[model samples]
Target: MVNSLSKRCISLLPIYKKVPWKSIVLHPIIHPRFKFTCWLAAWQRLATADRLLKIGVQVPLECSFCNNAMETVEHLFFDCSISKAIW
Candidate 1:
């Protein structure tokens, strides 16, 4: 019964696609902390403000740097005016 239940749970999991940037993120020269961060970002699993609010944490939705838009991974990394300038 336990074996059957485990199989059922596994089958219910969403199948993820191959991550194209896996090699670059997991390169040996990359620092372990940076590698872990990059892996999370690649998976859209970084604890950005939008994700925090979705999980019911009370956080300001606006970007802390630009205060111009909702704080999402894309916005924080690429779209925010301050980040854009830094990049």
Candidate 2:
């Protein structure tokens, strides 16, 4: 199965491992299975593919913890005000 898929992406054969395939294709970083499901859901609510940057229609974009920097998918999970509080 891996070999068949690899053949389809032959042009990317050289540096596939370094390409963040899980994050780029499978979106594992965004859809983590268990531990961070709640956090992931929060991120999804904020930045679904069809809703990217269309913040005004939904909740405000400010960080819930800081009330400052825009609450993007990347920021909330990795670099936001509440992360420090939780840690």
Candidate 3:
């Protein structure tokens, strides 16, 4: 079984680590919505402009906050002027 190609590929695959559930869910300082948003952002699962383009949304790729930059996860979170102020 160990010598099989399937088992060999499985061994080469990287491990999937999970975040501590207590830290995200059980914490008092973090709001429930905030935790959900954080999880979505971490996974790059938010529907930003770039993702929209990939999914063929056919909309102009402009940052909703800054209107000068492409609306990507990084731009929306860190690079946009308005987001910078929010941070």
* Best-performing candidate as measured by lDDT: 1
- lDDT, candidate 1, 1-87, per-residue tens: 999999999999999987788898979999999999988888889988999988999988899999999999999888998998998
Write down the TM-score for model 1.
Answer: 0.74
TM-score of each: 0.74, 0.39, 0.67
TM-score of 3: 0.67
Writing each residue's lDDT as its tens digit, candidate 2 over 1-87 gives 999898889966576444333344455555455425554454465453235547445666577677768776666668876886687
Model 2 misplaced regions, further than 4 Å: 1-56
| Residue runs of model 1 more than 4 Å from their true location after superposition | 1-17
lDDT of 3: 0.85
Using TM-score as the measure, name the better of candidate 2 and candidate 3.
3
Query: TM-score: which candidate is best?
Result: 1
Is 2 or 3 the stronger prediction by lDDT? 3
How high is the CA lDDT of each candidate model? 0.91, 0.60, 0.85
* Each model's total of backbone clashes: 0, 0, 0
